[model samples]
Target: MENIQCFRPTKAVIDLQAIRDNVVHLKNMLQPEVQIIAVVKANAYGHGDIEVARTAMEAGATILAVATPDEAVHMREYFPQVGILVLGATPISFVPYAAANDIMLAVFSQEWVEQAAKQNIDRSLKLHIKIDTGMGRIGVSTRDELQQLYDAITAASHMLVDGVFTHFATADEEDTKYFDKQVKMFKDFLQLLPKKPRLVHVANTATSLIKDASLQFDAVRYGISMYGLAPSPYVETILPFPLRPAFSLQTELVYVKKIKAGQSVGYGATYTAEEDCYVGTLPIGYADGMIRKLCGQNVLVDGKFAPIIGRICMDQCMILLPTAYNIGEKVTLIGTQQGVTISIDDWAGKLETINYEVPCIITNRVPRIYSN
Candidate 1:
């Protein structure tokens, strides 16, 4: 997959320097002793994982965290020495590979630990105990469960408890009541452990950015913010430093034509020209992750807003241009054009979703071009 070459005009431009700057800012904000776990899960939230991981490490991140065993293994192939942790549940079958590669697994259940220990592996598998303070996604819930899981891992000569962590459900919100409760529960669970692990991380991107420094503990997992995106609007307001967005969606107009009055553009004949106007077709559409809901959404053409007209097709979509633009004229979907910009947040607003989903939904059909 890495060797596949894409010759498409519609491509995602990734600024690696922005990723480096984000990591550097986060490193400066954390305590001197706190390690930064660069969460490069979901292909670095669709900015490309391996590249982001490398840039983040160069910028001071000490560990790379992914969501699945396959992602961790893929990263391990590129970075043999760097620590890679699987933040999600690992299949028992991956234990041998994880042990052999020195990858860490997030352990929450006694059953998973018992099954993992049965695998025939020559190396010790590093385990991170996950606590479910409130997210209810994964991890042990009660102090008893945490202590029992710790005991099982400690008893297994083939396994080592290297870290313990919890996810926050409200850390990105303005409200602190639920966030405070999760913190207290996590601390209480920590007290149950006979000996603390080398790492006791509890903060995600939101907590690391907006919460108190004490919550940072031994390390903080930097995720959404690592790509220069704030976890939420509330967190964005109180950011300790500015974030430089690293992703930009751009394409050139492939076809342009003038339509007379009453002529419609695109499928379903939804958009009919009331007067003579120009329409430009971009070489990207729903199949490229530009979903159809964005049909009336504004894109940048010649540094001005041009509304997407008609039903967004599978491979192409028409935009109502202010005038007839030459073929190959640049159109900005999620980036700056001249002095104007169409941000990811703007796309999120149009789609009624979060900013994180904007880039992630942009399919791999669009090649990601990295720029340092």
Candidate 2:
């Protein structure tokens, strides 16, 4: 077996410039006073968090947002002064950790405030209230619940309301019925608040890009779009500016051979050659987040397209090549080669998923290389 960690050229190359441009584009599109909170969650959506966070902040983002307490903690190492907001719930037990690190937690219930107040920690915690304006997730759904939660937080000397936000379920879709309903509910929730928080945010990447400008509150959580990815296929068409994808997957051919006509390749003998053909083996497969279902997808080699011929293996996969190639020839699995390009959208379409899942699934084994 080959050494998996040494000399393997498989990498997820990230372009910092694309991220900076995207953030600046979003900043320019928003009102002068509206702030851009770069959503650096999910390891910056699998493009590497610390790198993306620094680049985004340098490009004008004033805040950083993540999905969990651990993520918030990890971000604190690199960004000591910038605001870090946990979009997901932080258990009361971990509340002290967040408060100490100056990280804000999203509270959706009055019970959360009650528990946080019980903690003896001396530091005050900045918090955001998530109103369930229609994501149907962790948020207060009714006016009474909102009022109670607001009062509870305000009552606690250790807790301070810094922001209030909601997520939209259909902001990326073409239809406006559900999207408008969410906006209305968010407005109604705001009406019930005794006094508004310093930051009132509900616009996500999709909402900020395609929805009404009034929805762009004090700040917008720029998530997928900050990484230069369209929120959905529909949003791609209406995007205010062109988005340059910041991610690409690359590798190199490790082995090559010519198979005779009628020969089968890969496990289970699922691929049989109709004629003598060149087959190239790559040092990447399912364990690297290439998942088995993508067995028949196309990969770019030498500026041309090659079909993946059989079941992708745990450590290797076979691609039909036009001709015999050197063992170290470059291969493009998810990027531009010559004039052709393979995009995450292409992979998502074949897998029946979304662009977000495409990069998120590309396991950590593949090293991430950054570029300007």
TM-score of each: 0.98, 0.97
Best by lDDT: 1
Q: At residue 365, what lDDT does model 1 achieve?
A: 85
Per-residue CA lDDT of model 2 for 1-372, tens digit only, reads 112243578889999999999999988888979999999899999999999999999999999999998899899987899999999988888888888888988999897789889987789899899999878889999888988888898889979998999999999999999988998999988988878899999999999999888999899999998878899999999999999899999999999999999999989999999999999999999999998889789999989899898999998899999999999999999989998999999999889999999889988888888889
Clash-forming residue pairs, model 2: none
| Model 2, position 333: C-alpha lDDT score | 92
> What lDDT is obtained when candidate 1 is compared to the true structure?
0.92
CA lDDT scores, all candidates in order:
0.92, 0.90
Candidate 2 wrongly placed segments (more than 4 Å): 1-6
Best by TM-score: 1
